[model samples]
Target: MCGIVGAIGSRNIVPVLTEGLKRLEYRGYDSCGVAVLKDGALQRARSTSRVAELQEQVQADGLGANLGIAHTRWATHGAPAVHNAHPHFSHGPGAEAPNTKPGHIALVHNGIIENHEELRAELQALGYLFLSQTDTEVIAHLVDHLYEGDLFAAVKAATLRLTGAYAIAVFCAHEPQRVVGARHGSPLVMGVGGVDAGERFLASDAMALAGVTDQIVYLEEGDVVDLQPGRHWIEQAQAGEGGAVAHVRISEAQRPVRTVTAHSGAVELGPYRHYMQKEIFEQPRAIADTLEGVEAITPTLFGTQAEQVFSQIDRVLILACGTSYYSGSTAKYWLESIAKIPCNVEIASEYRYRDSVPDARTLVVTISQSGETADTIAALKHARSLGMEHTLTICNVATSAMVRECKLAYVTRAGVEIGVASTKAFTTQLAGLFLLTLTLAKLRGHLNAEAEASYLKQLRHLPAALQAVLALEPQVVAWAEAFARKDNALFLGRGLHYPIGLEGALKLKEISYIHAEAYPAGELKHGPLALVTAEMPVVVVAPNDVLLEKLKSNMQEVKARGGELYVCADGDTHIHAEPGIHVIRMPEHYGALSPILHVVPLQLLAYHTACAKGTDVDKPRNLAKSVTVE
Candidate 1:
């Protein structure tokens, strides 16, 4: 995953580009750089650290320009070093120039170039000198090789020669007022700052342009855009016979610009120590906003065609990855038990590569916080190719690629989640999925009027329930104190809570750098019990359901292994504290909505544990908030 931001304006654009990089930092990056056309030459600054360090380097060197491209790279083809940082340049047929010298082309790229080996060899044979071990550098050299006159034409021709996903922003020293960009299999969007403002912008996500511009144009696959001061144009590329390069034709395309109110203020770390902590505490309001104005559950709540789509579906196929995959797993239990619909959840990255039965009548639901997840979008397309065309998405971003690809969508109002480890987004997705389950149950005549009324009341009370759960943070913090001293964690749950346990383990490992694993309580004797010792901390999600007795039996098994148990249990579970056993009583026992409540304490546990361990709670190592590249 990476981020790109470009601006062509009259005023000095250094601050705009750097601030855009700061906004996109949540996507995760190992290195950052900016290339700008200053005084008819390319001026660049790069750092193998945070964007703040890059900004310092820029200020110390007095780097400023009217037109520029910036990038935050999550290393894919190269190591996280200064040479591999983006804003790579090429000098064309001339001798290689110094870093501060005039350059023919400067480029920033987001996705992988799959055919770079061959391309690099060919460019090298043509006498182009390479500077960095990145596929992105090859693109910049290719653009320089093709540059006869126009930067836009050279970028278009370069895209025709490339094979793989990319969202690139390029600028030429000769064209001081222009920046060209193109995308294929990755996301790119244009921002309009109005005619009077005299600026046009490009970014991988609209959030990068927050507070600068509200208007956005989402570029489709194979679209190339030319951005100049106060003006822009888009061209769509159509493949010829067998998708050959010789016959590729370009035609002008009209992409509608929509006004999106970017939440700039939401990115601020208000009173919380970290974005993760703030997001965890915001779950109550997030769930409330996701469920607002829902007096009753109906098929149309998803979309206008949801009623027709729900009536035609016989089963459900959930596609997602990461935390979204866990949310989908939890929904499978709800859809099968409550709605009487057979449901199967698949990891998006693996689903497309494996053979599976794809029925046309099956409803395909995708879940993602950012709609731009590359694997999920590709999997959705793969399912559609196999005749599973009835598609729906539960995502946070309204303008994300997932929403555009799906026929129906339930947009979660989680605001902007800056933390790499998801908190509010996961809860909001569960809220949306539960609504879908209720709607399907009603459609199948499984939910009577009284049942619907009762479920609606429970849905309305979720905010208050989540609020009560957050009150247990102080208790969770106490448990975290004991957990901070350990290096390993084991989470145990039964039935629906099993996925919740998995999520808890994921949170702990992602932010705290602890090696954590989760298993169904009954699976302890199968293999995991052998790893249990006094050094291992066991977390049990013990809701007062039918599985409580069985879960208690599992807790006894852990106790017999000399393991310390940290349990989040209901007040009336009758499970009390004993030697090697610690219990944090939950506020109340929510029947169908128990998973939503149980997950909050686990999140708080991970948050406080990471805090005690002094790990980076927002940007976890080697993890990107949005997985844009597969």
Candidate 2:
């Protein structure tokens, strides 16, 4: 993942880029850099540190430029270093000294260049020189090699040749007044700004354009825009000779700045040191926003274009990466039990490599918070190639590739997840997936009138139901202390709780540095019981539902082995309040809507346990917020 921004029509651009980078930094913070066109040449400055540090250096040097492209990189192709940072120079694969012009062209890129090695080899054979070892260097050389004196056309041609996910911003010496930008399977946004009576702004995401411009246009895949003084034009990006360009002009009054309120966990003053804590407090609002537009279904739940496909689909295949894959696993239970549909949940990275049986009638549901997960996008493309016309995405980032590729999109309004561990994104995705399940069940007529009415009532009541769950935080904190001295744990659930159990274990293991395992309440005897000891804590999800009795029995199994039990239970007096076991009361029943409520306790447990360990809860050790690069 990387953050990219460009400005051509404003005051000193370095400052604007700096501010924009701060907002976009959540996308990438491994390294930062800027490419500014000045005095008929391109000048570059960069850093292998945070944007705050780099901005300090840029200010100290008194660097000033009106138009430029800047970047904050999350290293994927190269190590984190100054030379490996963004704003990479494009001399050639091995260029000697032919194009040593100071400001010929400068650019920054996000996403991967799958054909980089091949392009580098060809350029090396042509005697093009290289600097740092990064796939982004190919964009620089591609721009230089395709320069036709017009920066926009050259950038467009370069994009046409390149294959894979990329959103790039470019500037050229010949066209110092403009910043040309393009996107292909990667996120990009064009912000309309009022700049000294003339100019344009382009950034990788809306956050970069937040204060600069309120009116922003999300660039579609295969689209390139020509940034000019006081005006800009968009050429529908085409691969070959037979292509058409669509010209659309935008005014500056549209892009408005989002005024974020000073929430309890938003700012880093002192107490809760990390942003992840701040974001945790914002979860309630985020969850509400995710349900805002989704509640109002249009003429068709899956959209008009996909209506016919949706009506014909017999099964569903959900492909995703990481946390979203877990969300898909949870959805599989809902779809199979509630919607009565046969569904498959596959990790996108693995799905693409395996042969499978899917066709026009088999709907493919892809889930992603960023919607830019490399394998997920590839899997979507693979399914589309196989004539699977019915497709949808449960996603957070609306500008991501999955949103553009999928026939139907369910957008999760969990805005700007900075922490790499994924907190609100996962919970909100579950909400979206749940809604999708309801929609599909209704569409297939499997949810009978009585069942549909109950589902709707539950859906409408979920937001408040989630609030009830959040109220259990104090109890969760008390329970986390039980595991203060333990290093390994086990999570148990039955039926639908099985997925929640897995998710709980994943959250604990991912950031808490604990080894945790989850199993169906009955499956513990199959194998996992051997690992349980007094030193190992076993967490039993005791939601007061049909499976509560079964889960309680499993808790006894842990206790029989002298394993400490932390039972997350509801006020079910039937739960055998055994000795050497801790009970944290969960929210009351919400029928099938329990998953949403079940997660809040686990989140609190994970958060407080990590706090007790004095770990870096937000940044962790080596994780990036979005996996923008493959």
Candidate 3:
């Protein structure tokens, strides 16, 4: 998914828009651009590098615009290039342009406009000219030809021609004092306050407008807003009747820009010698940051509407893609067993396409680090369409479209996760999901005071315990030297630990490009036993629990096959290591919750092994940050 931001105020807007884009870069960062209405004319610039390049260019000149919009483009219809970037204009299409001898418009969009090709062919048939090979270019053309001095109406009319998801921001040369914004399946929000000169801002998330204005409100799907310096109004009419037109007042607490601390800690090869080793050391604080404000959650946390939705929901459908999907799978089992409710876990990519069994009583919970994951967003929309009106999300990106579309939201404060293979995100999602389970149990009166108190106590101790486990990363790195040259590996676990084995295998595959497979310990004999050999490394997730002895038996099976065993066991005594078996005795045995601790070593092993292979850990091959496009 892409990120978009717009601002109209007496203050210079180009700098504001660019800064906002930086704050929202985590949404998607393939390319970036900015379009500003300045001096009664439209000025635009775009680039295909990290946002830093665009920021460098913007700073080359005095950055200033009373009204402007910016975008961080994630490739959709075209490849990642300057031409494919957003802020597309209507220069050629018999449409008004910057050279239209009068006026032009620049538009930046986040979601895909499904009807772009058809719209482009229609415009071409109408003798309209075209510029870049982008779906967004159609909007610039439509806005220009359709504009009759009313920008909002032109946007409203233009949106009618498009299908699929979108959150678009538009600016026109003739209206330097104004801006227009609209959204459909995609998410958008506008921060509505300022201290000096009443400088209001529009951003994809509260992060972009953070420090500038914490008082922000979101624009719901199918909602549109018109902007003016210090004030704005809603576009009372929409092309579609599905989304409502309403005014929501936002307060300062709803948004906060974290004080970006400049860290001098450039990773080095001293002693422990890897970013993964260093990052592993950072897990304690990471868990704590994610736990911030978690206790405030109650049945009434989000208001009466959320309470009503929670009360009425008979079951849950946890939808996600990738690691978040794995988190959902774990939550599904937890919700059913602990919360005593039924749940269906679906990979978001397949959710909307399948003949989903959904209804009004189902609450669809979409999980994603960046809320822009395309399939997840699409699934959320699909569920809402089928009358599953209650939607909630546990996401890292609070400003992400996923959070904006849903009625309730829970944010994981993992901060900037630069690695392509998620580490902290997985654990934080577990934390959030556990809380969600507790919330449901509390609401249904399934959890008594003693149970709730015990769980919360365990939850509170997570950060500290996570700290102790993270300190073991140095020891894990010592084990990774063996993984560097391995061709295939088998991961073994049981019970809740089984899903964790799946996640560990996934993390290794995602970043390291390793051929790894996971099997439930019992199922190891069923089929995967054929693959275990002297050369194949078997990673046994032997957390101390009810299944520990059964897992030990599986490890013994691997040893019989002469397979090299790397046991991530809870304690040394329980591991029963032979001459060939190596063990990493965990700092603590957290019982059923041990998977949360055991998963750490696997993440470190993946990261270090990938680093040893010289792979790009932050941007793995063919993998974009978020899968906004299918």
Candidate 4:
């Protein structure tokens, strides 16, 4: 995944493009570049550094243009060098070079082109030379060959020959007044900026449009957009009714552009050194916002139709990816134990590739923060195709595609999560899923009035409880000093807490770049115990549940092997800080909600460890904030 931004206006758009790229840097950070239509040609600057360096280059070169496109790349096709950065142009030192001026359609792209090899061969036959080893370069050359003095027509023709997920922004020196954008499986949004006769801005995320414009338009799949100074139009390829073999027809339409006043204030990094640290500390407010007006647990907490859907369903199927998948796995323990519903969790990317029996009575639940994850959306559609129509989602963005596609939704009010490793979003998702579990329990008659009230009381007290857990950050920073020196670590838990261990390990590996693994305590003696040594740090999640003594023995096995143990035990667990074992006592036993509290220290541990290791905690290497491409 990469980040793309384009703007067309009367003002010089170099600062606009650079600011948009700065906000979108979470999507990609390997390299960044900007191209502007200036002085009858395209002036471009590329850097193998961060967006800030690219901005400095733009200012130092004094590159100015009325319209431009910028990109921040997460290298998929080539190395992270200046030569491989975007925005890419079509001219190179070969037959493709017609001795023309610069800027023969400069383009910035987001997703992968699966058919680039075939397209490159065809373009080479036309005597077009390629400069960079990126699929986006092929697109620039193709658009250059097809241009008939109309930039939008040339872009539309080029996309018809391409296959795979992409969100691209194209600009031409010949048509410096306009910029064209197209999307297939990736995300792209349009915004209206400026005061009188506003400018048009396009980006991969709304956060990029913050403080510039609150009026936003989310593009749909297969939508091609043509943007000018104060106007825009859209075109879609309409297909005849023959399914995949249908004849395709082109149709153009224009709607009154609706503007949504986005909450841009959430994007600010207030009083924190890094966005990851700020989000980790914002957990109390995040959880409080998610459970603000909940007085009781009922099926209606999800939606009005939730009761009807739950009554007809006997099994639950959860589809998700990455951190969301681990949240779904945690919900499995609660869904089955409390709700008495048989539940299964599937990795969204793998679920659609295999043949499996689907039941009509199964409730399919999709979990995502952006709600634009391509694999999860495809998996949800596949389940629907197999006769499972009852669908729901626990998503953070209310306007995201997953929320629109599902029949019912629970939008988590975690605000905007910008860090690559999710913090507030994950905990808010657990809170939402816990609410789902309680609702299903009540519907199945598994939870009586007294039991429901008790769970509600615990739910209402979660914000304060999370606040107390955050006070343990100083001690977690102490443990992180030891972890910062280790090359590898093991995370251990059992029962409901095993999924929490998995999540903890994921956070550590994602942000800190540490090699980490998680195993159920019972599985330690089987194979993983051999990797235990004095240099290997073992992090344990031991809540005061039924598995406390069992987890203690697992801790003993690691200590016997000369491994340093870091435990986040409950207050009553009796685990003390010793010579070989380090303990951070939790405030209280959280019962079924222990995973929510136990994960806070793990996040702090990763953040502080990455800080000590001198790693980028906000944007880790080779990782993007959203997996928009499969």
Task: Report the C-alpha lDDT of model 1 over 153-256, residue by residue, as the tens digit.
Answer: 99999999899899999999888889999999999999988434678999999988888899899999988899988778888787567966442334334588
Can you give the lDDT of residue 433 in candidate 1?
Answer: 97
Model 2: lDDT equals: 0.76
What is the lDDT of every predicted structure here?
0.91, 0.76, 0.76, 0.88
Task: Please estimate how well model 4 matches the true structure, expressed as its whole-model Cα lDDT.
Answer: 0.88
Task: Tell me, by TM-score, which candidate is best.
Answer: 1
Q: Write the per-residue lDDT of candidate 3 for residues 43-89, one digit (tens) a residue.
A: 77789877778988877755567778899887877888887888876
**Which is the winner by lDDT between candidate 1 and candidate 2?**
1
Better of 2 and 3 by TM-score: 2
In TM-score terms, candidate 1 sits at 0.97
> Which runs of model 2 end up more than 4 angstroms from their true locations?
91-103, 125-129, 236-275, 287-309, 397-401, 414-416, 443-445, 481-486, 576-579
RMSD vs true structure, all candidates = 1.8, 4.4, 5.1, 2.4
RMSD of 1: 1.8
Models 1 onward score TM values of 0.97, 0.87, 0.82, 0.95
Q: Which stretches of candidate 3 lie over 4 Å from their true place?
A: 37-42, 59-64, 93-103, 193-195, 236-315, 359-364, 370-374, 384-421, 436-457, 486-489, 525-536, 556-562, 576-580, 619-630
Error of 1 at 401 (Å): 0.8
